[model samples]
Each structure stands twice: as C-alpha cells, then as structure tokens.
Target chain A: MSLAKRIIPCLDCDNGRVVKGVKFVDIRDAGDPVEISKRYCEQGADEITFLDITASTEDRGTTIHTVEAIASEVFIPLTVGGGIRTLQDIRDMLNAGADKVGINTSAVLNPEFVREAAERFGAQCIVVAIDAKCVSGPGEPKRWEIFTHGGRKPTGLDAIAWAQKMTAYGAGEILLTSMDRDGTKNGFDLDLTRAISDAVAVPVIASGGVGNLQHLVDGIKIGKADAVLAASIFHFGEYTIPQAKAFMREQGIEVR
Target chain B: MTHLAVIDYGMGNLHSVAKALEHVARRADLTFKISVSADPKVLQAADRLVFPGVGAMRDCMGEIRRLGIDEILREQIQHKPVLAICVGMQALMERSEENGGVECIGLFRGEVRRFAAGQHDAKGELLKVPHMGWSEVKQRAHPLWRGIPEGSRFYFVHSYYVQPHDSAEVVGVTDYPAPFCAALARDNIFAVQFHPEKSQDSGLQLLQNFLTWSGHA
Candidate 1:
C-alpha cells in the first residue's frame, strides 16, 4: 500500500483571480484561478485547494463560479474554504464541484458544525483548516494557539487539542498552516506540523511555508504530513508541480 | 452513438467522473455519450452504466432503497455492463459493518469490513483510516484491465474493505498495510474501490477500456 504523498498547490483567490501573500497579508495578483489550477493538474499535482480569501457575502457568488470553472477543467480533488460558515455554503461548494470543503473560522466558532457537516455530507469531504502560531516564549513550554480571521484573531484554544477535537468531531482531514512560516519561503513548521500529525489519526496537509522542492519533501519526510500545500512558488512558475514531484521521487518519497 | 450513464443517487461528485469520461472520449475520438442521471429509463437505454457512491454505507443504502436503485441495479446487472466505484462498490456486498451494521444490495456474497483500529505498515508505524491517496493496485488478469499496466496506482478514499466469499471474484488487490480487494469482476459487472476519474493517465485508459468492453470475457 504505497499511498503517494500528495502535492497540493493552493490558490488564494479573491473575487476571481488568484492571490498570494505572507501570513495572510499583502495580497498580490497571481493569475486566473482556473488557468493556474489547470496548469497544476497537468503538472501532476495530486490535488488543488481554492480558498476564497476575500470572504465577503457579495463575493461568494463569484468564488462559486470560479470553483465551477476550475473543477470543470481540472480533474484532481478540489477543496474550497474561506467564508464557508454554514452547511449550505458547504453544499454550495460541493455543488460547485468541490470534492471537499475546508472550514477554519466556522469550525472554531461552532465546533458541532464539523460533526454536522460530516454526518450530512461525508467525513471524506470535511477538511478542518487550522491556522496556528507558536505562543511559547523563553520560559514557557511549547504551545501553539489557533488563529482565525486570517490569523488576526486568537481563539485561546491550543492547536493540538483543537485538532484532536476536530478529528473526534469527524473532520476527515486537517489543513494545518503555520501563520509565522506562511509566505516566508523559509520552510514548513516541521515541529508544529509533526505535532498535529502525531496528534491526529486523519491525513494532515502541511501548508504555509514552502520555498523550494526540498521543503515539499521535508513536509512529508520530517513533519510526517500526508500532503503539502504551497503557493507563490507554484503560482509564479518558479517550480512546476512535476518538478516538485520529480524532486520527491528522487528523494525516495512517493508522490503522484 | 454509444450511450453511457453514471448512476447518480445524490451520494457522490458525479461531475468530475462525467468530465473525465468526456475527456477520455474526446481523446480517444470515440463516439461515446455519457450522462449522470438517477432515472432508470436513462440507465436502461445506455450501452454501459457506472454506479458511483461516497458517504456512509447506511446513508448510501438508504438512498438506494428510497429511489429503487437497488432493483434497478439488480435487474440491470444480469444483462448489461455496470461499473461501480468507492461506496458504490461497497454497497454491492451483502452487508457492511459500518454504522454498526447496514444491509446492502446483496448482488454478491461479501461483507464490507472496517480496517481494524491501529493498523500499521511494516515499519510499525500506525496507518490512517479513510486511506485517502493513490495506491498501486495489483491486477488479476481481467478484461476491464485490458490496457492498464500491472501494479498501476489508482486514487482510493475509503475506510471499509470488501471481503468477497469467492476468491475468483476479486480482479485486483491492494494492501492498506495488508491485502484487500481493490477491484472486482463478475460477468458484466466491474467495480473498483478507487476513483479512476481522479487517477490520471492510467485511469483514463481503464475508462476507455470500459467504454469498449462487450460485457463478456
């Protein structure tokens, strides 16, 4: 059972165009979401995630259209999040061709929403997106807190504990993002990623800190993440999905 | 035109499957027509049928009975070629242990069993359930496997594995740390636990073969 490590290129879309930023700020235009996603699929991306960064009520319709356009062309598994606050939004995303829905803010606000969504749809379709940042300082032991609203608000909940709760609540997968490493091009927070990966039984997709192919390999090899989701590098054409996959294959890591 | 229908019982993402079939058909330049419908008449008229499902076994079986899809599948399986994927394949068993226990269509003598808790690979590390990723499926010489190579990887996302009563009914096997049925074939019926639509190149080839198959060995 060689389950290939998945390489997912995340599209931070707002309105209709793909955007990129550092720690969920300084958003810049990348390209059309559909075109970029289609390119990634051709490049052997295992999956694609489209997050509607601008989660306004008015812009919700446009995001659905973009998800539809992308899914109509791209055959890979598509997960959509941002502004997905209710079961109806989840149903809309699935109807828009999303195979999974990532819930961050909503899941934190109403934990039972996760269980309800999973029961109504399926556990395979529910993805809990966790944006965490290390709060541990000098004398304090290691601790990470969950952040919501693009990392602007702290939930006072420990990231690891929340992940365990989310899993028990029926979240089939976890999209763990380190707010500090996001868009830094440094590397994934291997410690935090591994912590959550070890804490949960479901698949963990490490996101928010990839600069090169080696980082992609480390996300799985070191952090023990089941998948890696990256932006910027793939969006700007610095490295294609195939290039990263080749790097993983050379690293002796299975990728599809 | 060669008409194909993918059975839609409100349990799966049929759009992607339909799109993949259309893409493969266009690439192969075959005169194929495909649609995702729950109507029995549309399914009866098609040259081929695909039964695709996801979600819990209990809900899937509930919907199958609520819509009379069980009768449709049972009657059609005898004469026409049918393909099932994921939970669609699990529902083909006599019963599933999921949701405590759920009775299924009973088209075959097999029970869907959940992966024992705390499953691990050779490394002594625990393996996750829902087995969500691509795994190399070991083929067992079947007509539907026509052009697909041996040990080709296909996308799989499931927790329960089907245990067929007859070994010959198994057409392919994959290990989630242990060997289990990955693909099955019986007469005009061909079903896989993986999502060929999401699997890429080799997956498209398998779909192409199904389109051309004559429901005979």
Candidate 2:
C-alpha cells in the first residue's frame, strides 16, 4: 500500500480556546483547544494543528498547558504554530507533547534559525510555514510574495524560491498558506500549491480556502500537496473528518 | 505489577510513548508501572523495555553511548521483552549512512540507508523523502500483530530505513516506492519504524499486544 494523503484539522487557538479568523479578521470563539482536538482525533483526523493566535506573553502559557492536556490524552500527531520564534519556544512546545512546530516569521526574519532548529531538533520536527499572497494580476505572470505578521506585510521574497531555500536549510515539511484565499473558502490556490510542492523535495501541506471535501481532493490531486489543512469546514461541524476521508477515497485519493 | 521502562536518551519526546502505554495499560488484565528514564539502574530493574528515539544517527548514538543505554539495552534484550520505535529501530543496526556513516548498537545485523533522492512510485509520481505520513504496514506472524490486521496503516516519520541482513528477522514491511523493513523481531526483541503511540487505534492495538507479549515469536 502507498502512503495515504493526510487530512489535518487546523485549530486556531487563543489562550487555550479555539478560535477562527476570517481573512485574519472577525475572530469567533469555538471551544477549548484540548476538547476540540480530542473530538477531531476521534473523528479520524490524521493530525491536529494548533495555531496559537494569542499575542500576549501571559496567555501563551495557556497554550502550552492546552498542548500538554491534549498530548496526555490524544493519540495522534500534534503540530503547534504561531509565535514560534526561538529554539526554546520549539523545545517548550515539544516538551509539552507537540510533535512538530511551524516556523513562519522567525524563519523569514533570520533564515538561519531554520538551520539551527533543524540541527538541534532534527528536520522531522521543524516545519517551515510560508504565507504567500499573489502579487501579480490575473493576466500577469502569476507571481506570489512571502508575507509576515499574519499576511499583513510583504517580504518581497518569492514563495517558490523561499520554499526551496527552507527545505535546503533542513526544513522537513512546508506549510503553504494562501493569504489571499485563507478564509475565502474558494478552495486552495492550486497553482501556488503545485508550484511550492514541486519546488521542494519535502512534503508540502496546503492550507487556506477549503470549503468542502472537493477542495481537499483538489489540494492533493491538482495541487499535488502531500496533505491538506482546513479550519472552518471541520470546526463548524459542516463535515466530519470521516466524511471527508470517504469522499476523498471515492475520488481515488488514498487516505487513512 | 509489571515494570516497563521507556529508555530516554533525550533524542526525542517520550511523553506520547509513556502516555500511550499508560492508556492501554489501564484496561489491561495485568497491572503495569511505566517509567521514562535513562538511568541504568532503573532500566535494569524493568521487566520490559521500550527504546524510542528521533533525530540524527550520530547524535542518537552519541547520547546512547554517553548515557550507557547501549550496555543496558544489550543486557536487557537477552531475557526481557524490548520494543524499539523510529530511530530506536535504526540504532539496532551495525551502521547508518546518516551523519556521514555512524556505528550503531549492533543488536541486529543490518545497516540504515537514506531514501535515495528522485525516487518514484509505481504511478511515476516522485516519492518524498522522510516518508512522513500514515502508510499501510504488511505484517507477518508475530504477537504484536495480534489485533492489528494484515495491512493496517500506522504513522511513520523518518528519512532512513533499516535493512536487516537476515530476512528472518523482519516481521513487517511497507512500500514507499519500494518494500523496506518496517518491523523487526527476534526472540525477546521487537522493533518498528512507525510510532505506535501516534498511530491512533491500530497503533494502540499493537502497543496493547506488546504489553501482554511473552517475548516469543
């Protein structure tokens, strides 16, 4: 049998509670991160990702406690992203039972931090998160630039080139998020996903703009992403993970 | 109570492994006391052992040697049951190509090899290295495979795979463009490249079987 395409449910967490932001605005509370994660695990989610959106230092402590509580009970791969700036931050999350940590702003700021984190903690646990926004117009040559501060600022770095560089610097996986489509639910940026997926040798997880199970399939079939990450589709109980997997399986995409 | 020690060399997280064992042990018929330790005394006193690891081969071997777990593993494997996971399975080999070729504990006659770049599957699709995902594991006859079906999927995350010199030692295999040893077994030792702790239900079943295993084929 071949390796199954992964279905990961993204939980945007704030101070131990799950939240969702539409296009990085209009935040809404969901539930406890730990409780929601357990439900996702039970629903046959291949992995669970917690994006800690809490900006305050005091509230960050709650994220770790939330991770610890989930790790103690949930028997699945857990990835924590957002505000992972240092090796100590990565260590604290891992020690709190996170299987992987996503490095976005830190990697773009220093670039060397990716190499250092990989050297210290192995490439398997280091995931480079790239937030890309389409800079070129529809008729133009389809160019995308890396963005920081939750897709608010542009770094002028090419998304394809940055992905290749991160993998070369020892990133085991790439979390590709389409800033333009993030909460739009129009489906993933297929062209952008395919570009980054083909550019890097490591696995690429396609994030943003997933409204239905078909979007998940398109991410793997058309975008060629090794995995698909979604927030609202699963969070709002619009569809269960099993249903998504079944639909993907019917579409002939192997899923566990 | 049966004492189980999960050997920790500070290579990777042992929290999931310990927690998984505790979860399975709760409903088990036998009482279990699970501990995560690097101390020789604690390892030597355990009735069963779990060797879990992640990271570079050189660093893993370095910590294994520095902490004297190599000797403890060699001693404990003689009689008690032992289960190795991920890089821990790789460490049982004679050597590895990782970190520019490093020597391992030599419990099994094998060598670790990296997944060659530009490898393709049957569909002509380029297979990614590190093989990070859930893949179906084809099992052979073994106690740890009791509740797990013949081709159940398990979670795996690694760049290199073990190649035991003797085919008789391989208890499970998975295809990542090609068939590779996913699980190894002998009289008192059972090792796997996949993480049973993070593999959900099927993985939990394997660990539950491991807890009740008698160290026999």
Candidate 3:
C-alpha cells in the first residue's frame, strides 16, 4: 500500500549549511544541514528534502557530502534538488544516499533531459520541480508560468501544461512550488495545485504558503495534494510534525 | 538508579525520543539518566524502558531479534514498566501486514492491521488511517492517564492499531474510526499509540507518571 499523506520538512542548503529566511530573503544562519535534518527526523518527519539553491549556478557539486553525512545518521528517504542538470548529477545525488533527484532549470530548457534522467535512474528516482508565478495583466490573466535559476527569471512556459509534459517525459513525481506563495505564510494556491495534480499521474507535493496547522490540513484536504511541504513553521518550532498530523487527522486527511 | 533505557531496535527515531524523555524528566523535576542502548546489561540496569520505533512492524521485530535482545526485553517487561510508542506499540501485537505476513512480538494477544476505511473502525467515514497529529485521549482511570487531563490531546502517528484481547486493558481511547483504544496497560506493560515525549506539557506529565508508577498491574 502507498504511504499515508506525509508532512515533509524542507531544508535550504546554501554552500554546506542550512539557512532560513522570510520570502527567501534576509538569509539567517539556521544551522548545519546535517544537524537540522537529524532533528527533523527525530521529530518524526516522514521524509526530508534538501534544496541546494546555489549549486547549479556556482558549478559546484550537488551537496552529496552533506547528504552522505546526514543520511549516514538519519534512516529516512532524502530527496535532493538544485544543480541537478545531467544524468551524472542525478547519479551523484543518488550515490550520495539521496533517494530522489529533483531537476528544475535543465528540465525546462531541455525537456529531453527529464526523459534521459528517468531512463538512467528509474522514473521514480526523478522528480521534476516547477517553480511557478502567476502573471496577470495582459489579456485574460496569463496562466502561471515556470521560473528558473532560483525563481529569478520567467520562462513564460505554462506550468500546468509543462507538468503533464514532464510526467510524460518520465518524472515520477512533481515538486510544484508557487513562487508568489513561496514564503507568504498565507496558504497554498489550490487552483494551481488542482490543475497540475489533475494533469499528472505522479504524486504532487504542494509546496509554499503553509502558515499554520489549518494551512497544512487545507493544502492536503482541499488542495488534494499527495503531500504538504513546509519549512519556517517547522524549523522555528511553531509546530511539530506530530502536531500537524494530529490536526490533519482531525480534518479527516490520511497522514503518516 | 533512575536510568531510563530507550531501546534502539534499529528501526525508530531513538535519539529524538530520548531527547523528549529527557526534557519531560527535567520538567517533572526528576533527574532521569536516559541512554539508547541494545546491551542486555544496560537493559537490566534501567529502572524503565521506552520502546520507540518507526517504519514497518516486521522490520522493527526483525531488528529486535537481530540485535539479540528480544528475550531480554520480554523478561524485563515482566519486572519493569515499558512504554511503546507508534510502531513500537504496533510491534506488541501478534501480526502485521507490513511484515510480509510475519508475526510480531506477541506481547499483546492481537494482530496489527491497517486502518481500513470501513472494516476496522465503527464510523463509516470518520477516522483516516496513519492517524497523525495531536488528539484528545478519553480515559477511564488508567495509571498511564495519571495527572493527564481528560480529553487532553497527545501526539500520534501510525496506521495499524492494537486491539487488546481484554477490553479492560485499554485505559485511554480516542475517536478515530469510532473510538479506538489509545493507551493500554496490562501488568507492568504500558503502551500508547501517541508520542508522550513530543506532546508538550500534558504529555510530559504522563511520562512522569510512568516513571513513578509502581508497576502493580
């Protein structure tokens, strides 16, 4: 049987350490990635996702060293993203003890890269990430488009359509994030989530805009996402995974 | 003499559970020497045991036997109080689906099965499986519920449930699929589906009660 809905704690790895911020701005030193990951694992996080935001641009290796150190101690699935362009990048990530590899820009630029990665490392090992932002202004409010290079540039590619294509190309899962809601603490964009979830067969992890217990519950129950991803709410001790799952259970969502 | 041994069965969040218990002990104004060990000598010297586990029931039981501490654990449980959380509580059952159809610790006379939507619990569409979160525990005078408020919420995360052979052993119950048992006590064996160490102040009180309990059964 498939796992129950999971509450995942996401760690943003800058250089070699874990960092946090509001709206991904004013970065503050959170702690070592390994230490933070261990804490989350102990607190009962179903899984951990580490996003190396600077790796792709810096031409540095995937934070496999960080993954190895953390995975050696933590006995849970570790999903890694950032700077994952080629099949070699995916191999390095998985070899470093990462259970899955997330690709964003390269997958968008070369759609075939997604297919190739899936061929090399089983579709289940490949996760296509879509960082989308709502663009409304010209004629009928343009659909949410994809962003790359750490949410800095807009690709003008429709997110929903691209998600279907990515899954078609061989991604096992889609880590869809709403840039507009990335650090807002408001809640998730249900419309975008539903659209993509409906378009793809793979599990959709609804990321961004988790402010409180209700937000987590609403994201899963209302948004119909397979899992909910959050950071500040967990890292700051605002709520623990068990607490969040309890609230979700109350709302009748099947969470682990 | 108050050394609390948290069993590292190789399939659980042992360190975090130890830290939480340590915090609860500090809060209770009791000094509890907590450590994670698989040594039988360490298990024997402990005043109490907290059997904490995560993942599948079969894998957990395999770890217990793999570490060669299953017999020692059964022997120790007869003399001292042992608290099992989440999957650790599930391991006390007779069998589980996750174990590739293998038997569990058989500590309790029941099988651990998934929380099927309509079959297990009474409610048609009320409780969901993998019951996660902080929920209220309704108790009727169990030692494990000592000092814990009525309807006080505790943390829980698991899909399988322990159906005790004797109904009286279920001291606390929660409304998930029509009021299932949340806490069980039989002789010196005490197990809860919820994580008391992570349940904040109210949960810490429950841990304190376990520490001081005389294991009178």
Candidate 4:
C-alpha cells in the first residue's frame, strides 16, 4: 500500500487562549479548540496536535476537556503535549481521547522515562518532541542541539544523536522542531529533519518554518519526513489542509 | 440497543475507536451503546466486539493472556461480530516473528512476519521501519467495506505484517513495498492491520458498517 505523507495541524494553546498562533483567526476564547479542530479534520488533516505552552494544572484540565470535545466530533487521531511529565499525564491524555501524547523536557530529564512509558503505553503512542537549534563556531562543524523547557534550556545533546537514542529507547515517533526556523516563515530546516529521519527507523515529523505549500512538500521530499506539522499556516486560514494536500499530490508526492 | 464493546487489554487507542463509533452512531442515525471494557462479562454481553491493539506483539499477547482475552475471543467469535485491528489482528495468527517468535491465539491460520529492514521501494528511496502514516487499501469484497470506497487511505503503524496460510481469507491488500494483507475476514471475524479509528471519514464509515453488520460474512 502507498502510505501518503501526513499533514498535521498543531494547536498552540497558551493558558486556554490561542496566543501567538493562527495569524488569521481571532485568538480570543481560544477560538474553541474543539471547533477549530473539527474544521481541520474536515479539510483532511491526518492528525491534530495540541501543545499547552503553560501546562498548568488548570490548563491541563482545560486541555483534557478540549480533547474530549474535539474527540467527540473529529474522526482522526489527536496528539496532545506540553508539560507532560509523568506516566499519569500520558494516561490522562489518552483517557481523554488523545491517540498520542508528546513528551519533551521530562524525557530529557529522565531518559529512561521514554522506555518506561513506551513499554507501558506502547511506543506507537509515545512521541518524543525535540526542540533543537543549530550551534556552531565559525570554523567548526555545525550541529543541532536539543533544547528543553520550551526551547529555553540548552541540554547540549546533539539532536541527531538524541533521536537515535530515543528510537533505541522505543519511541514510536519524533516531533522535531527547529527553534531557529520557528515563526520565521522561511522554510523547514531540511538538513536537520533529514539527519534525524535518516538516523532513526521510526517516522519523523518536521516542524517549524513552513511558509507555503512547497515547504510542506520539501519536508517530505528533501527532509524525508513522514509527516509535516504546522500551526499558523492552517490556523489563520492561510491554506486549508485540502489545498496543501492537492499541491503535494501535484508535486508527485502522495498525500491523504 | 446496539452495543459495541471494545476489548481493553490496557493498550492501543480504545477511546478513539469508541468516539468514532459514537459519532457514527449519531450520523448513521442508529441507536447504540459503546463501551471500553476489560471485564469479561461486559465484553461478552455486547452485540458486537472490537479488538484494538498496538505496541509490540509480545507484550500485547502478554496482556491478552493475562486478561484471558484469547478465551473470551474464541467464545465470542462464535456468536457475535468481532473486529480486530493492528496487533489485535496480528495476535489472531498462529504465531508472530516479533520478539523471537511469539505464539498467538491461532484464530486465523497464518503467521505474522517482520518486514525486511533496510528495504527500499521501486524508487530506490530508503523505506523506514514501523511503516507509519496513511496508506491506500484496496478492497476485496468484504462486508466491512460496505459503504467505503476502494483505495481509500487508512492509517498504518506496524513493524510486522501477517502472512496468512490461506490467501483466500485476505479481503484487503496494500502494497507498501510488496503486496501484503491489509485486511482479512472469515465467518464473523473481521480484522485489519490499519487503524480505522484514525483513518478519518472512510474509517468512520468502516466502523459504521461494522456496527450495522450481522455475523454473516
């Protein structure tokens, strides 16, 4: 069977509000995360990911409620992340109708947490989110370093090496985000994405710096990512998921 | 009332499948009760059953054996409609090569084998393991495909695929690098390697079809 590269719409929910997300939609009231998600599913998004920037207890409840509401209507898979520290958090998200849960800082803190959760919940649902930025000297070789605490804390771990380790630890997928390209609207860091994808046997999702439809295609074409995750591009009605899929199909890339 | 019980051995996306069935119940205008249950009595009482599984086949079978899901499956398969997915489908085979050849429920006459690592497609591009993402499934005269179109994309994430001893039991085949069983059906049992719950509209349709189907095909 011809497996089409996936297109995922990421929702960045900050304190129950859509802050710095979706350039075209009004951020007030978080624009109803449930409603926004349903529209994307109708437009043929393969999956939806929700990131709670603050990840407070109150926001966690809100995220769970939002996931329930969206899960009731949306037929596709849903992934939720941000401040998911323990196994209980993953269980709560999955119980709240999330198909997958993304983990970042917690995994960096306790690398074994990846193996623990994957073993308990199955690696199929454990997504290790890597937020990375290129670090290099003028004459030295360049490499992407893993950043945690929402890209604030530099862990000094090589992104590519960490990806390989996470895979060995039983991570089903890697959500790799480029801190340098995020919100820049330039394009994805194809080199970084390709490196991690090449290093791991599991699927890698390319995030950050998606300006147009072509960037999405390039993620799969040049970066060799299994999926492309975007926020404002689809949030503000910049481009519907169907339009993006059509463009990718036109480029001889399979999209569903 | 139609009740669809999703067998829970503590793995896979049971809620997603339940939610999709709930949506299909409303959309199809059919009254239904969907439940995710580990209790044998609750599962045995349902009008239909959905066996959803994920993770490594070894652990999946471990929980299945621990919870006596195999016994329940055998008893229920004779009387009610049962739908299996992913590792749930894999576990129906006689054995699996994953985790050094784990024996399964022997419900279907087949063996599950791992896809060759470092395999490449016709284009010479490297084919990754786990086969994650959406793939088009070619239908083959199955009642579970009643309202769905042929060649519809279904989400797949697995390292091993089933190689049934009897090829006639295969209903849907998808070509990742080579043709393999994507779905199979016999008697009242219907199983698929793809995740219909995550496959969007077409997937919902498949669930709806399962909800309404009797144990005929």
DockQ top scorer: 2
Candidate 4 lDDT over B75-169, as tens digits, reads 99999999999989999999998877799999999899988878788877777777888888998998889878889888887878999999889
- Which lDDT value does model 3 have at A70? 72
Which stretches of model 4 miss by more than 4 angstroms? A21-30, A56-62
Q: Which residue pairs overlap in candidate 3's backbone?
A: A245-B132, A245-B133, A246-B132, A246-B133, A246-B134
Per-model lDDT: 0.87, 0.90, 0.75, 0.85
Candidate 4 structure quality by residue, lDDT tens digits, A169-194: 97889999998888777899998999
Candidate 4 docks at the CAPRI level of medium
Give the top-scoring candidate (lDDT): 2
Interface RMSD of 4: 1.8
Question: All predictions: root-mean-square deviation over Cα?
Answer: 1.6, 1.5, 8.6, 2.6
lDDT of 4 at B39: 94
lDDT (10s digit) by residue, model 3, range B10-120: 555554566557666676788669878898889999999889765555556777788866687789987888888877787787777663576778788876665664333
Q: Which regions of candidate 2 are displaced past 4 Å?
A: A55-62
Question: Chain A structural similarity (TM-score) per candidate?
Answer: 0.97, 0.97, 0.95, 0.93
Q: Candidate 1, which segments miss by more than 4 Å at Cα?
A: A56-62
Q: Write the per-residue lDDT of candidate 1 for residues A15-60, one digit (tens) a residue.
A: 6889998878898899998889888888888889988877833334
- Candidate 2, residue B192: the lDDT equals 97
DockQ of 4: 0.64
